[model samples]
Target chain A: ELVLTADMLVEGVHVPRHVAPADFAYKALAVNVSDLVAKGADPTLYLLTLCLPKHPEPGWLEAFTSGLSNAQADFGCSLAGGDTVSAEGPVCLSITAAGTLPAGKMIHRFSANPDDKVFVTGTIGDAAAGLALIRKEVSAHPLSGEGAMREFLLSRYFRPHPPVAAIELLRQYASAAMDISDGLVLDFTRLCAASGCGGIIEADRVPLSPAVSALLEGDAFSLEAALTGGDDYEVLFTAAPGVADAIRSAAESRGLSLHCIGSIVREPGITVVGRDGAPMQISRPGYDHF
Target chain B: ELVLTADMLVEGVHVPRHVAPADFAYKALAVNVSDLVAKGADPTLYLLTLCLPKHPEPGWLEAFTSGLSNAQADFGCSLAGGDTVSAEGPVCLSITAAGTLPAGKMIHRFSANPDDKVFVTGTIGDAAAGLALIRKEVSAHPLSGEGAMREFLLSRYFRPHPPVAAIELLRQYASAAMDISDGLVLDFTRLCAASGCGGIIEADRVPLSPAVSALLEGDAFSLEAALTGGDDYEVLFTAAPGVADAIRSAAESRGLSLHCIGSIVREPGITVVGRDGAPMQISRPGYDHF
Candidate 1:
């Protein structure tokens, strides 16, 4: 038996209340899978604990189970055992996934080194932009593809994908790695804390989808949202400088967009700079459960 | 690492609302540790997930943590990681405990023998009787020393002593086992299902505390409550009849009662018999979360 367990996601707290049931189901399992992937573990077994508000709507449970069963089939995991109970308010989904690693092969958060290259896979900030769009709060921009990108961004917010491959690949090449959950900057700060290293990230090198760029327009503050607004399940990792070529080639072969935007250093805090080397201060810190 | 996780308890569900917070604190961790003992797993780590109705009253969390810390010290376990969140209703504590099994020593529920002797450690129905006492619903009985027995029964309900020693003992001799959570009858039925076997239980042989007997008087209907009410946290197991002597002596030496009340049969359903050999109908079946 490999290390197997689960965490819970309450509806109003873990995910926003407006999320679709199907997306909620998919994201719930994906978030758990992301935990396993972060540990360089493959998902093999899962136990689902569901607390429903009422007798669940038949159609909703069907759709939710469809997403759950599909994810299990796609990931080659099996349902083991779990309990279901009634709750008075929000729906709660807790999944415990179990998987094994080869002997002596476990990656952790405290292994990054000074002088390592910091990389993130896939695009960032689209989910944040989508949230802004959903809230009807983002100002109009001069970008020509605003309409198309806005729809795409909104959809991305509903179905954030976990970068499982990027995380697994880095387990072999990266010194220390973690999935970007609480925004890139905040989570990177945590990685720094865990690894006892400092990092300097070039803001301009951060990957931005067209949707994010279109929403940002020329506003530097939009980047603050990119730095603090979470739900973009991308992999952020640090690798030795010597593996840079391999990292780029491996990501390219997988059609993953891997960006090296920062470097770890001997110091102990995170510093983010623009192209001109001016430090950027995010208006809001990362999401705090409290 | 061993798999570690926990679920929290809230007042009004696991305990009565009038119960002391201090008692609730101890019960929370004790119930979770019972799950570990059921698996014959040695406690190594714990994660506490506490949701509070409000910022806890002064010293409430402190007292809770003190109890949890004490339990950890008793079991040689330590905390790893956890999260605290706020809830609008009752406080909930969820604990995930991680434990280890020596190589090839992991116990499971699927290996019961057809003729294995069914045994349970410690007495049953005491917890249910305690609950009845708390509710002030038990019939008046004049048994001597009933007051002290009631106190002990109530304490057992409020703060179950998980059979940590029984885990090691059962691992040495038992073929299949699980902690009795949803009453002995219900949990044993589940065990039979898991092992694909049936059983014949002698009603008179089921272990009962004096308090439970006093509460029931002569009516055996209360036996159903004893057999099906949840939260006893005693270890129920099955082993070859040949080991009955060793099992009895081991439990006796430990000052714990090991009662052989049933025998797993080649058939496929649970059949309970009284002295007259008639079928007994239990009022409360095993707890069903669904």
Candidate 2:
């Protein structure tokens, strides 16, 4: 089966106005690759359309194309074609990626069983924290000033590493799968809604990077912010509980971290339980453009 | 074989800032279809990426989508998927169209032979004249004021009727094919450059709509503008002289007017001969974005 996906990123709205063009191009292509990976597809080709603002600074295009070249090599995809035009406003970039997989092997969000164990690849909320740092809403002072931790968070926002290498594992094990573009809770809620079921996430079980954990420990950040903030390109999926060990082993073999964060239930809504075993209140579900 | 092409349109750059959303949408899709048709492929699906300015006026999206729907039906293609995002500047629209043709049958602009006859579909320069009327650079007063002729030129500019229905005729007859987008002289020059040959166009043989002819007769427009104006969206192709009769009959049976405008030559430059049968010096060949 062939899988096709398109993504658009506009300056200021999607990224900071003064973002590095190399980072901008990398994130633009990575996001689309995330979509294809979530569907258990191996990305093969992509077409790019760039609407560049009038009078771009010298070397901006060179840096941007260099970034795309790096991304193409990393993702094992080629740039088939593209169009470039001058825009009167901020720069806008769009990429349409195409991939292929074995027939009937696509992982969907609506196929999770009621008793499926929810799994997510990599740590969640890192990219969101990175974005928060970029917006200056949060400080990296809690994590020992502007050091490696700060750079880590910012890099997560600029260059997302979606688990493209886990395609085979997900195809073999995941009953339902989708990338965590929106916040984990919101995206998991969507999966539940599509599958006509409910889910319960144990907050303590949610994986966090050392930087996020350090900030949480320092009382500089709230778990709620991590739960509600989006931009995490990690893959969230579900599988039968019987295959949990097998899935874990396969992920480990591929040098990937697989966390069992929640479970699917027959109930009709999503719930996040605190460490105290009480339900947590979410002020906002996720990012909504409208 | 699968064929793909992408085009980008930016407000105030590609179209007027206050242009109708329906016309904008139609032209976006039509231009991509023209590319597929020129390659002798049947457009099957398209992906649209819309970078809409923040807070678009009411009903703009509705009209844009309605235009896309109409175009999809007209072109026998469907919207596979797309992405929409808010832009910080003027609206920017990008479309990546995909088509399919039998392997080894795709037409190319670099395959023209030395003695191949050049043919163009339908009339040229009508869209360019329509654009002049839009920009108020020229007046329609010479063609009976704001009557059918006025509307005809405007419609030609807004809704380009690329010869998509002549794909089969082109595939069977043309040695080299390409859509005339960046003016007749410029695009033909590109074809000649790619084919390592030259071409000569007879000025009197270039097809012109009655509206354009009337404007020319009234001395309100120059044939040079028609030859050099872009956005014609008509197919320009070359075929061997042995199949000229077959191509003509095939185009006629399909209700298409195929005009034999010129012939490819072994020389290394393009020459346009005037009605007096002398080489005409072109002040400007075509549109150049840079």
Best by TM-score: 2
**Candidate 1 chain B: minimum summed lDDT over ten consecutive residues — where?**
B1-10
Looking at candidate 1, what TM-score does chain B attain?
0.91
DockQ by candidate, in order: 0.28, 0.77
lDDT by residue (tens digit), candidate 1, B1-290: 24343444556666787457778867867777787787788877765556665466778777777777777766677776555656565565566667777666666777899999998888887887788778877643544576787688888898888788787777788898888877878888888889999888888898888777776674522777888888898988899999999988988888876899999998888877875788688665677655
Clashing pairs in 1: A5-A96, B5-B96, B5-B97, B6-B95, B6-B96, B7-B94, B7-B95, B8-B93, B8-B94, B9-B93
Give native contacts recovered, as a fraction, per prediction.
Answer: 0.10, 0.81
Expressed as tens digits, the lDDT of each residue in B20-69 for candidate 2 is 99989998999999999999999999999998866999999999999888
Off by over 4 Å in 1: A1-6, A74-76, A102-105, A139-151, A218-221, A275-277, B1-11, B17-25, B102-114, B139-150, B194-197, B217-221, B275-278
A1-290 per-residue lDDT for model 1 (tens digits): 25444566666666677567877877777766766676677778776656665577668778888878777765668776554656566676666677677666667778999999998878888777777766667744644576777677766676666666664576678788777777888889999999998999999999988767765765622787887777777778888999999989988888777899999999999889975789997666576665
What docking grade applies to model 2? medium
- How many residue pairs clash (N, CA or C atoms closer than 3 angstroms) in each of the candidate models, in the order given? 10, 0
RMSD of 1: 3.5
Clashing pairs in 2: none
